[model samples]
Target: MKYFAVFFFVFISNVFFAQEKENGTLVNGIIKDDTTGNLLSGVNIINVNTVKGAISDDKGVFHLQAFANDTLHISLLGYKSIKVKVTNDWIKNKTTTIQLTQKAYALEEVVIRPYVLTGYLEIDAKLIPTRENYRYSISGLKEGYEAGEYSPNAFGRVLGSIFNPADMLYNFFGKKPKELRRLKEMKKDDTVKNLLASKFDRETISALLGVSKSEIAEIMERCNYSESFVKTANDLQIMDAISACYEEYKILKR
Candidate 1:
């Protein structure tokens, strides 16, 4: 009974130690350019044979967690690759500083002619008009050119058709004759004509027209229109467009 108890105690201790070993560890490090000593961001650090990895942040700091026995590989776009072994001591003391040496490249010096036309000299630069252009144009006319009595449902349906070509085709040719007839009747409504005549806010109009915001602003002011309409325009994702529109609108408003 005494010998059996000793064996069971040893077995339990072994299992605990095994579990502790499997828990692994984490190592934090920074990547820097060797030549300039500048911090390098987006350095790729991975295990040598395994798929585990982490990318350095904008501050060149990175933290990687893995088994203490695992090997690590580090690489940067313009730097030489490095492989390092993660030892038990290294795991216990977490932080590390990794400096990646930049790879030197040899370039054969050659002078090339400036007027080397490789392909077609005159490429077609004309913008190809898609169905989106037409839909937006109609939308612009309805929203900007005429704002009063805007049919949100009709406009939404037309916009939806531009996105869903299959749905548009189904609606045009499908067996729902009653729905098609109703849509035709709605299209010919007199209110639609009145709605199209209301002046749209310059910014909103420009967005719908897919014109430069500034350009539309200028057009509106020059035409003696109110900048008050600008409030209807949403925050645009395109920075350049927004900037240009704001600049032009300022000048035109002046």
Candidate 2:
């Protein structure tokens, strides 16, 4: 009877300790540039198992709750990514400092030439001429005229394309002066909306907005971005789009 009592107590204590260990602990850390020794802001720190994450503050500090043995992925733009384990010792230390190496890239060499030819006939605006074919631009234009090679129709069409009359008409429709300006603004807005949709997935949107997957659709729909607009904006521009759309979402909630 005595032996069984001790065995039962030991088993129960072990189970309780295991359960406590699984609950995880909060981890605090600072991220720095490996070489420069400067704090890195906006660094993404994510738990490999739970997907829970946090971004470093201006001081390059982050705190995240994670399992004791979970791996933390740390990443930032222009820096090499790294992973750290949330071991028992790390937790006991309360906070740790990690440095990330910068990713270096070798750029290709480039050669620059004159912008305009003095009298080159073979080369057009497209730069499609062969390397061996070269001449002065003034001489080329003079010869073209002497040979009666100039076509008014083609030249007129090219000039018209450069100075589009439709663009003038566009402003005329919108109170004359502001019509073109308004159209440009509308185009920019559409570009922003499409940029957000393309760069961010449903999960990413949820993470940013602090919303669930089901709520993302309605929020995105309210953004009013066209599919074509997304193809126009680049990565950096897309961040501005995300901020604008998030503000729009907040407005809708109000």
Candidate 3:
């Protein structure tokens, strides 16, 4: 009878442990602005398949129960949305922090005028001299509008007829050029962040490079990850960057 009771107890305990494991993990993380490094609240975070989610509090902390197979989608207004892959570390720490980059707004041929020309006709206006007057006028001759020659003014008009003011502005400014340095990486989604947090956590990174756990902090610093790389690179590209950084660090140390 005692042996049967012991067997029943072990079975019940194993069943409970299996149930907990099957329930998956409760993942938690903080949200922040990549550019300003400020906490973001009220951000939406949801698991795509499960639809289980949470919103960040004033402190940017949030929690949601999710499985490793789940994809957590995070988003906010004026910022790009991100998808984070659930990982064991996320389940363990329950306090991962992620920075969301703000989206850049490009002005499309903006012409801001305080005064409304309500009555005026929205049309191009040009004054041209009569033929005889143009022939005698110094301004017309200097302008290459001489009567006997091909009307340079006619060509100018033709060019202006097809001209796009936006194109002209772009030409002057060189293709709406965005200064990469001036442009903060608020646009990058969370693929890289998730990669860093999941794949390069202290344990994983330490094992990958055979580094001691005590040196993980120094290893992270030595890698010298850039904001742009974090924001822009795809998974494979980020991995390459990490590998390169690790190699360089080894060379320097030796």
Candidate 4:
């Protein structure tokens, strides 16, 4: 009788553990931008009161296991974060799409002034003393972009590439007149941001902007630049933009 009772208890424990491991309680979802309806990759999702968490992949999909009453917190840069209560009913339904709204920058009471590089330098000299480090960082970022490394931050990478001063001059004077013209059209017509948003990563952006990276990839997709003039010009513009940002940072610091 004693042996039989012990055997029964062991069997029940095994069944309970198995059910916990392979139960109907699973949370799966996708994160996307509310305005554009584009999937947002690299968004972080965490359980608010627990250490459990996951990150959205390239396809913006995430899967996590939870019990009936767990709360999930979702966050991404440039967008407002959201918290959702997970119940048994929620888990049973599965397959959720969480929409994140974009946060608008408040422009009220803010003064708009023309961007003057020299004036920026004079002000920076008082603020940040480590100006040389900033320059070195930007220079390194330019080099990484030219070498075809993807940035980690999407916004930072696009800004770094588009605002590079050396690249602008090179395109103006280089051989690929047609390509340079296309770039100009993209810039003037305001399509550059969209193009980069669709393609760049945070690491790629950080590399382009002289910021730190959480993860780095060994390879990046090469830009389609067949014309020598276009290629040279684009490269120069990217490098120059990074330099310019660094220069401004130095000036502000001083």
Q: Lowest summed lDDT over 10 consecutive residues: which window, candidate 4?
A: 215-224
lDDT of 4 by residue, 47-102 (tens): 53333556789989988767677667676778876767777666778878889998
lDDT of 2 by residue, 150-204 (tens): 3224223323323454532112222223222222232343322333334433433
Clashes of 3: 2
Give one digit per residue, the lDDT tens place, for model 3 in 1-254: 99999999999999977876776677789899998989999787756545455778999988777877667767776788777888877776776889999989897897885543445454322222223211212111234222211233422322332344443322322332231111112113243234333322233223223345454333222333333333433433333433443333234334
User: How many angstroms is residue 78 displaced in model 4 relative to the true structure, after the best TM-score fit?
Assistant: 0.4
Q: What is the TM-score of each candidate against the true structure?
A: 0.35, 0.38, 0.38, 0.36
lDDT of 3: 0.50
- Where does candidate 2 clash, by residue pair? 118-137, 119-135, 119-136, 119-137, 119-138, 120-136, 120-137
Ranking by TM-score: 2, 3, 4, 1
Q: lDDT per prediction?
A: 0.48, 0.52, 0.50, 0.49
Model 3 is weakest, by summed lDDT over 10 consecutive residues, at: 132-141
TM-score of 1: 0.35
- 40-84: candidate 1 lDDT, tens digit per residue: 997767543233457789989987766777766676656776777
| Candidate 4 Cα outliers beyond 4 Å, as residue runs | 1-24, 107-254
Q: 1 or 4, which is superior by TM-score? A: 4
What is the alpha-carbon lDDT for the whole of candidate 4? 0.49
